[model samples]
Each structure stands twice: as C-alpha cells, then as structure tokens.
Target: MAGQIPMTRNGVERLKEELHQLKSQDRPNIIQAIAEARAQGDLSENAEYESAKERQGFIEGRIAEIEAKLSNVQIIDPSVLNADGKCVFGATIELEDLDEEKSFTYQIVGEDEADIKANKISISSPLARALIGKEDGDVVEVETPGGQKTYEITNVSYI
Candidate 1:
C-alpha cells in the first residue's frame, strides 16, 4: 500500500508479539478487573470501576493502533537487500567519529525499532539521513542537538 511504514522483519515480529500479549493477557485481565469492580456496587463513586474503565480505554486504543500499524507495515529483510555497498535502510554501518576517533556500529531501521542501546537507529534520524547513500571512506556531517558532528563511513554491510 502507498504510504505504508517500512519495518524490519524482527520489528514486525516484536509488534505482533506485543499485540498478541495485549489481546490475550492484558485484555482479559482488564475485563476481569472491571467485572470485579462492578460487583462492589455504587457505580458513581466507585474509584476502582472508574480506574478499570480508564485502563480499558487505553488498552483498546493501543490495540487499535498496533493493528493499524501492522496492517500497513512493509517488512524489509536486511539479509536480502542489495544496495551496492552504499548505506540504506536495513544496512548495518560501521563508522569512526572524525573528532573523537571512536568507532561505532549501527543498523538503520524503522522508527519503531530504533533503540540506542541496541545500536539501531531510525532512518529519519539526522545521523542516519546523513549516512544514507554514503559509501565506505565517505565522511558525512550531521547536525545534532550538541551541534554538528562528523563521521567517516568505514564499512556498510547488509546483515
């Protein structure tokens, strides 16, 4: 579909797992809580019932959101992508900080899968945007919150 969100295979799997858990476990638990709260009587001043209803609304909203995203998701597998050694979505990149000489590795992924702790960066991020379409040995400058930073692309691999 047009305007579908691009996501890695692993990202899609994680989303599916979360949706499943929410529907199977959380939804049922919330329903039980609401039923128990309803049994306490006095609906207008029932704090437990009100809280359960609010939680139910949040869970339902999240379920709809995840379902919509999954329906419009475009799964991209990194291992099967070929970009001619240039940086692109699903490409794992190795870079060296021009100023600090620090080496780092990151995989350009969808927004949902961006985790700094895991070295996964969103494709729309400043650094990822600068690195995109760049080849090995190329230097790119990125405008960051801490001012401009430069990095040299040491390697790019689809893994």
Candidate 2:
C-alpha cells in the first residue's frame, strides 16, 4: 500500500465510470471522427483531420492517466472506518469560520476526487493537512492565498 493512493469507494467508482465512458464512448467517437475527416480530403490541408487527431491524442492520454490512477487506487469505505473522533481521510467535516461566522462542510478525498464544487478537499491540501488528526471542537488555522483563517471543527462524520 506504500504507493497506493487513498480514495473513498465512491471516488473509485466515479473514476471507473469516467474511464468506461472514455474508452467505450469517447474513444470510439473520436476514432470515427478522424476516419470521416480523413476520407473528406487531402491530409496536407485538412483542418478537421488535424483537429480530430489532436483530440484523439488528448483522449488517449486521459485514458492512460485514469487507468494508471485506478490501478494504484486504495479504496477506503468511510462508512466502515473507525477513526474515533479524529479527522482522517474520507471523513466529512463541518467547520465554522471563527471570523466570518460561516459554516462549511468538506470531505477529505484523494487528489483526483477533490472538487471544490462538491466540497471535497484533497488530503494533501493545506487545510486538510491541518485538519487531519484533529477532533471535533478543535480549532484549526490554515494559511491560504487570501490570508490566515481559523475554523472550529463542529462535526466529523465517517460518511
């Protein structure tokens, strides 16, 4: 497990789904597009063919990247974790900003699963790093691009 990347079960499933789509749908579509473009005209001045080839390269690169990540994934089920009251990987945490009096929730996830829109933070992020091993009611201070911010851990849930 030394080289394995820790990710939630849900994260792994999402990645697998994306990989399936890329391989089964996107790859074939790009191949078809390239073939159609090739049939249209001369290879020397074919804009469509050039664009399709570039897109095909991108799609293949992404497929390789996803496959590599999936192969090295270490899926962790948050529901089955027993980390006591400490914040750990895959733990969903509710935090209250001490200065702004605002509440925020975030799940610690692998780099590939981190999405700010979904309130998921990468485990290696500054805020997650500060929160890890901390318990509810613990105050965490993190330095960000804006400035230093303080948050009090209000709740920590495995799921």
Candidate 3:
C-alpha cells in the first residue's frame, strides 16, 4: 500500500459517491450486459460481449482504485483548521500578482480536489508549495511553466 492519501471532506464524499455508483449501478449493469451478450451464441465474433467485458474491466479497476484510496484517506476539513494566519493545508489564500497587480483567491487542497478553474490548487503545485508556511503579506515566487511568477499574500483564511 502507498502512503496516506490526503483528502478533504468534500473530496471523500465525492469519491464515495462514485464508488457507490460503480458498485451498485455500473457493475451490475455491465454484468447483465455481458450475460445478455453471451446468450447470443458465438463469443469470438460477439462485439457486444467484448465491449461489455472491456467495460467490466474498467469498472472493476475503478472500484478497486477507489477502495484503496478510501482505505488510506486522511480527510481534512478547512472550516475547522487553525493555522494562525499561515498558509497551510486547507487554507484559502488571497493573492496579488506582483507583476500585473491582479488579485486572485485560491484554496490549497488535495490533488484529487484541485481544480484550477474553481481556484482550488493542489498542495504539490509550485504556487501552493511556495505559499505553504507563508503568512499574509509575504511575497512568494513560483516557477511556473511559462516563467517565474511572483505574488504577494494579501490574506489567509481557514474557511
């Protein structure tokens, strides 16, 4: 088994929902499809059977993956965190681009919950790594793919 998978409360709930859907709905439906396809005679030339089998493999893989992740999950709730104004796991940070002077907000979250469009950054990301342990008004430089980017921490909040 790998190390613990860090996840937020919402991330765990989302994964649990997906696991439920796969086991209760997708798995059963795929089994039924395979059985129905098998009833149609020859197995070698049955495209439906092949497709169903492939889908079954995918579903089973997903189920196992979700199960493993859940088994090793470390859930964190941002609303209850107390970081004393420092950027840490589950901290929502407000930043100002030093180059462009534009303001942005991002929440540091687990990899599974990170969504750039939603302003949830992964803890392992360059910007998040730079922001970690930094207090409000601290300046941080991140090595982005485009180039080096600088930002000032305008605010830090747990929730």
| Collision count for each candidate, in order | 0, 0, 0
lDDT of 1 by residue, 1-159 (tens): 357999999899999999999999999999999999999999999999999999999999999988998999999887787788999899999999998989999999999899999999999999999999999999999999999889999999998
What is the overall TM-score of model 1 with all chains considered together?
0.95
RMSD to the hidden true structure, all candidates: 1.3, 1.4, 1.3
The list of candidate 2 runs beyond 4 A from truth reads none
Q: Which ten residues in a row are the worst by lDDT in model 2?
A: 1-10
lDDT: worst 10-residue window of model 3: 75-84
Given candidate 1, what's the lDDT at residue 117?
99
Which pairs, if any, clash in model 1? none
How does model 3 fare in lDDT? 0.93
| lDDT tens digits, residue span 39-155, model 2 | 997988999999999999999999898888888998988778789989999999999999899999999999989999999999999999999999999999999899999999999
lDDT, each prediction: 0.93, 0.94, 0.93
When 1 and 2 are scored with TM-score, the better candidate is 2
Name model 1 segments beyond 4 Å from true: none
Model 3: CA > 4 A from native: none
lDDT of 3 at 85: 89
